[model samples]
Every structure is written in C-alpha cells, then in structure tokens.
Target: MSTAAIDVRGLRKSFKDVAVLGGVDLRVESGSVFALLGSNGAGKTTLVRILSTLLRADAGTATVAGRDVDRDASGVRAAISLTGQFAAVDGRLSGRENLVLIARLRHLRSPGAVADELLERFSLTEAGSRRADTYSGGMRRRLDIAMSLIGDPRVVFLDEPTTGLDPEARQEVWRAITRLAADGTTVLLTTQYLEEAEHLADRIAILHEGRILVEGTLADLRSLLPPAHTEYVVRQPSLEEVFLALTQKDTAS
Candidate 1:
C-alpha cells in the first residue's frame, strides 16, 4: 500500500473556458494535518471536491487511502469523510438524535452507542439531549464533525471549517481538529486563515492563480520572505497578539 494518505499529480479542472485547477500537484502524508490556503476563487474548493470524490478532475491522477479517486471511487469514499464550511446537523433534532441518525444511516450495528461515545469524545455529553438549534456555533460545529466520524474514516476533509465562527468558537474547533490528528486521522484542511494553518498543519500549501504558489513547513515558507529587521520597538502588542492572549486567558479560566 502507498504510504501517502492522499496523492495527486498534474490535476486539472475547468468550467467552460476558464481553468480552475491548472496542473496542480500535492501529497498528504498519513496521520498528519495538511492545510491548503487560498483566497476566494483560488480553486481550493475545487481541489478539495476532486480529492474527496465529490467532483471529478479534468485530467491527471489522484488517490485517497490507497484507492484511485476515479477508478476506485467507492473505496475512496469509504475511507474518507468531508465536512463543509457550514454545519450540516439538523437543528430540529437533539444533539444526540442528530448523531444517532447519521450512525443509523451508515448502518452501524449500535447507532445509539456510537452516538453516546462520540458525544463524550466531543465533550457534548451534557448538551446531547438539547435541540441542536439551541447549541452555540461552536457546539454545533463539534456535533457536525462528530457526525463525519461515524464511519471511522482514515481521511477527513475540512473545507473552511471555521468560517463565520467567533474567535472562541474557532479555537474550540481548532482543538477538536488537533485532537483528530492526534488520533491518527489524516486531515486535509482548506481555509483562508493563515493562523489556522500555522496552528494545526504539519505542512502548508498556498494556492493562487490556479496553481500552488508555495508548499512547505511554516518555517520553510517564512524563509522565502526577506528577513525581519529588529530595529523598532513596539509600545503595545498587535491586535492579533492581544486577541490571542485574551482568548487564551478566557479558555484557561
């Protein structure tokens, strides 16, 4: 079996005359977090959709979990899960109910048991009986991610998972994503948040103009830019630093 959880080469896609993905190449190692960063319409979503088998590529070869994306799509689907930008849980259903419903749909032998276990894992046990509509944005996102794990997939694709979330809520989801990687699940994250990539990804790729502008460890990428000069003194921390500090304090308390 191939050691990579996802492998793609010469990937191309188009919508009519405009090319979306132009000969892209990527590799995601097993049990690590790989973040794809791009601005709006940079083909991040198209790349993710193709890799997850939701959309087919125009040309080139790709594989997920050792299964060819085109020729063995069923195997690819079986080994991976996708969580979109918005939460997909049913607001009318209780948190536990939503999970059980997905488990049952997946034909698990004990849907209720699976739901209960996931609730505990996600720290949702206390709110499991509450309607999903009543949960906070963070809680709802956690529940959505829990649903994706019902099949115990080897690879999980998170497409802009923290979009529209408050800083605290975003941090909550970040912790959950970090936990997923710690448990040996390969994570493919597509996002506009550069800080998120720095926080969670083992490797990062910047997609621009239908191609990867750069790919490497965070430190490696930093090296490409001109070195910073230590000639100035700051009177106060930057807004991002203050925000992070405040959030960390809130979380600690």
Candidate 2:
C-alpha cells in the first residue's frame, strides 16, 4: 500500500467556461489529519468530491489509500468514506437503526456488531435509540459520521461537517474529529473555519483560486505571516491575541 493517505498531482477541474480547480496538488501523510482551508467558492468542495470518488477531475493523477482514483475507482470507494456539509441519516429511523442500515449498505459481514461498535465509538450509546428526526443537529451529525465508518474505512473525507451548526454543536463535531484522528484514522478535512483548522489539523494547506497558496505545520504557517502579527499578550490582551498566544504555545509545546 502507498504510504501517503492522499496523493494528487496536477489536478484540474472545469465546469463550462470556468475552472473550479487549477492544477492543484496535495499529499497527505498516512494516519494524520490534514485540513484544507479556503473561503466560500474556493473549490474546496470540488476537491473533496474528486478525492472521495464522487466526481472526476478534468485532468489529474490522483490516488487515495493506495489506489489510483481514476483507474481504481472501486478501490477508492472501498477504502474511503465521505461526510458532507449535511447529515445523511434517515430521519424516520432511530440512530442505531440508521447505523445498521448503513452497515448493511456497505455489505459488512456483521452489520449489528458494526452498528454497536460505532454507536459506542461515537459516544451515542445513550442516544442511539432515539429517532434521528428528534435528535439535535450534533447528534444527527454524530450518527452521520458513525454511519460513514460502517465499513471501517482507512480514509475519511469531511467536507465542512460543522457548517451551519450552533457553537455547541460545532464543538461536539470537533471532538468527534479529534477522537477519530486519535484512533489513527487518516482524515482529509475541508473547512472555511480557520480556528477549526488551527485546532485540529496536523498540517494545513490554504487553498485560494483553486490552488494552494501556503502549506505547512501551524508554526511554519505563522512564520509566513509578519511577526507580532501573532502577539502574545497574556494580561488584558484581546481575544485574538490570546488565541494566537495559546495556539503558538500549543504548537511550540
């Protein structure tokens, strides 16, 4: 198997007269969390769709989880799962039921066992039996994520999973992503939330105009910007300053 979790070279995509992605290239290390950050309409969603095998690039060579995405499309599908901006659970079914259905859809050998494990893994055990329609957005998203893991995929693609969520719900989703990474799952995350990327990404790549503008560890990225741009004023510092200090400390330590 290839060592890189995701590999893309000269990836390009176009729709009608406009180019959505232009010669984009990315390499994500195995078992690490990589975040793609860009503003609205920056081709983040287009890139995610291509990597997850939901869409084909107009021109590029890409491989995901050791399989050539274009030639080995089935292999890519088998090795990865995708969670979009919206939850994908059946509202009429309870959370547990939704998970079970997903397991079955994936043709897992033991759907019940997979559902049970996912429920526990996602901390939805107590709420597993509640109808998905009755659950909070966070709970629904948890179930959506849990369902994605039904086949125990090696790579997961989350495309703005916390978008449009309340603060508390967004935090819950963040925790879920943290736990998934802790368990050594390779994650390719695309989000417009700068703080979220700073908090969870092992490495971050900033995409603009469908191309990478900067890519590195958080500290390395900060270095690209002006110094004192991230001032560390402990007492009476603005929240932004405090955030910078804390993030720098966390990165440094």
Candidate 3:
C-alpha cells in the first residue's frame, strides 16, 4: 500500500472577511507527482503555505511527512522544501554559489560537493561560474529548485514554477520535475496550465471556489467528459487547439 505523504482534513483559512481555503480536504501519496489545478485566487498558494507551515490555518488539520503542520510546524518545515511562483536565486551570486550557500545553511558536511553534484544534475555546470543575473529564465528556475534539494527533503511544494517562462523554458523545468519524482521525492505542484498537469502529474485535483471539485488520475478525470462518438469526417481544429498544437511542436522541436 502507498503511504500518504500529505494529508489534509477540513482545512480552512481566511484573510479577514475573505475565505481562501474553505474546508478543503486532500491526500497525496508518497513518491508521486500530485498536481493541484486552480485559477487565480483559488487558494492554491494559501493551502501550500499552510502545509509548508508558513501560514496558520483558521481551522482543520494538515500533516506533512507525518508531522502535524499546526502542532509540529518545525518538523513539517524540516521535512519539506517550497519553491514559490518566482525563482528566488540571488542575482549577485553564481549558480554554484547559490547551491553552496543553501547547503551550508543546511549544515551539510561538504557544501562544495553538494553544489557541484546539483550543478551537474540540473545541467547548470557550464553556467555555474556565471552570475545568476546572466542565466536564462530556465537556468535560474533550475538553480532555484536545486537549492531547495540541499537537505533531500521528503516532500516539495512548487507553486507554478513555470509561470512567466517561455515554452522552451517551461519544458526545461518540466524535465527537472520528472527527475524529482523518479528519485522518489513526493511533489505537490500548483499550476494553472492544464497541459502541465496532464503531462507531469500522476494524480490531479481541480480546485475551485476554495474547494476541490474533483481529484483523480488523468484517466479518471477524462472519464468525467462525455465519451466521443466515432466519425468518418475530418474536422478542423479550433483556434485554441491550433495554438496549442503549434506551441507544442515549437517546444518539442
């Protein structure tokens, strides 16, 4: 049986009169990529913050890596890493420096070795010596994620890691995320891109109006849509479909 890496029950959070997470409930299996799909102001970030112990929940309970977020905030924080929507690399530092700084902060025995290993793993070795300000969006985001792995936390929370990147850059980050899951790191990703969830997540949850409308595997979600009927006619693609198909080709090529 798969273990539950993150478990939430009746989670409620609000900012004054505004309810962000309205009695939400969720479960994420260990060593799997779980994507939370939502629109702007849908409380995705708020839920992530609560799970990461960065914010308090108004009610309900959340446990991450077997640690209760409210009662054992320190334990929960120690077992997970969070990457917000924006890359948080220091522009003044080199990519190598950024990783080394984080490893040292985590009190790793050999920060240099840790940095070097991550630099190679993220394909940033060639750019490791250059200042972070000189890196492309993808490189910076990769470095940000590398820094988050210094302590090999059990779970990772990524809040729209590809938000402002071009298609190519987004694809680059997607590969890195795949590697994380392959290495048995449980990941909770929040993304507005349906294609992203379809491509990367083992299970997906759609959040709306501060609650989960549905949660299941891609096949399960697809089953919710009406079954297609067989047709012998060729159909023209919709404008959105054309745009997506073209963009996918552009990224792949």
Q: Compose the digit string of candidate 3's lDDT tens values, residues 1-253.
A: 9889999999998898999888999999999999999999999999999999989999999899999998999999899999999999999999999999999899999999999999999999999999999999999999999999989999999999999999999999999999999999999999999999999999999999899999999999999999988889888889999999999999999
Runs in model 3 with CA error above 4 Å? 230-253
TM-score of 1: 0.92
Among the numbered candidates, top lDDT falls to: 3
Write candidate 1's Cα lDDT for 25-125 as tens digits. 99999999999999999999999899888999999999999999999999999999999999999999999999999999999999999999999999999
What is the full ranking by lDDT, best candidate first? 3, 1, 2
Candidate 2 local lDDT, residue 154: 97
TM-scores vs. true structure, each candidate: 0.92, 0.89, 0.92
With a 3 Å backbone cut-off (N, CA, C), the pairs that clash in candidate 2 are none
The parts of candidate 1 lying over 4 Å away from their true place are 234-253
lDDT of candidate model 1 versus the reference: 0.95
Q: Give Cα-based local distance difference scores for all models.
A: 0.95, 0.91, 0.96
